[model samples]
Target: MKLVCTCIGCAIEASCPYSAPRFYLGEGQAWARHFTEDLTRENIVKGLKETNYGRCVYKSDNNVVDHQVVNMEFTGGATATFSMCGFTRHQERRIQIMGTKGEIRGEEGKIKVMDFVTHENTEIQIPEQTSGHGGGDSGIVRSFLKEVCGYNGSEGLTSASASVRSHLMAFAAEQSRLNNGQSIELDDFYKKLLVQV
Candidate 1:
């Protein structure tokens, strides 16, 4: 595989395009009702008001940081950088991966691939997502249900070990962010975390 570097960003725009009113008052009214204790409009509104959903994102009382940048180096010397921000004009996730053979970039369900050896560029458009999180939420649920019914779906989530490794990377990224962007060794971090547990 020999991937040399990867850059990923998850952005939430500050333009309030996804505001509570824009959602609850519009196409997401059905979704709002799903979370309400009752199907009544008044109850849904009250339920939303009781939570942070009613407030402007910028004016919310929550103090959690709106941006994070993480740099990581895998055991084999490949590196990755991930960033999250709430300052863009739109909410989206983008990724670029560079390797010995080629590079790949994707955003908004569209992907572009460049092959260094063949000097070819290819583009692929994923199906439009009707479900939340680019259809990932439903995909995982469907995959899980299939697995539980004594069937192994080919498109399910990754293996358990890979999932754990990815989660550990996230934890290490948070630890690094808290420590002023200090580089974290995954092997050592894994050992230390295991000891603490």
Candidate 2:
């Protein structure tokens, strides 16, 4: 039995994504917390490539101590595990843009754009009113149509720089998590995007 287990471990080590062998043999809390940082689709994919573990494990034999131990402690823990296993039910999609002129919050089928300079807040309503994505899709479509057709009467909230800044936040959050929750300097990221220019 020991020989078979050793062989399995050796095979896993050869194929594991991490630089070190025995990925699960270390502190579980630290690893779990690390996984929560960044927590984006791309980073999650990278993490999975390095650590391949089953999202769900069932105990088929009464004599298997490992299975029993896992079954006893694994209930709500399946969400993250399943997420790592390429079983994501939905993609997280949000767009919030803040500028000296105003701010825009977009999700689902609604988009609220606020202009701090002019002290004006505008809410774009979606006709479909879908529950998914917080009504962002419809709002986006409406805004796009109005802008493209010159019917909005004013400029849209999102632009190339604003989009880049929003995405940079996600990247910074991931970097901070990997660095033990140390704050990531946003200046470099912003400079890369040339946001000020």
What are the clash counts of all predictions, listed in order?
0, 11
**lDDT by residue for model 1 (1-197), tens:** 62221111113322356566556756667667555857566776676666545655544456776898887776678988889997675568899999999999999789999999999999999899878777878887786777778665453474567679889998888888788878888899999999999
Tens-digit lDDT string for candidate 2 (49-151):
4443312122112232221100111234321111112223333445676666888987666789999988989999756544444555666667677778775
Model 1, residue 49: C-alpha shift (Å): 1.7
Compared with the true structure, model 2 gives a TM-score of 0.33
The C-alpha RMSD in Å for every predicted model, in order, reads 10.6, 17.6
Give the alpha-carbon lDDT of every model: 0.72, 0.48
Alpha-carbon error at 181 in model 2, in Å?
0.7
Cα-based TM-score, every candidate: 0.70, 0.33
Candidate topping lDDT: 1
**Candidate 1 off by > 4 Å:** 1-44, 55-61, 142-158
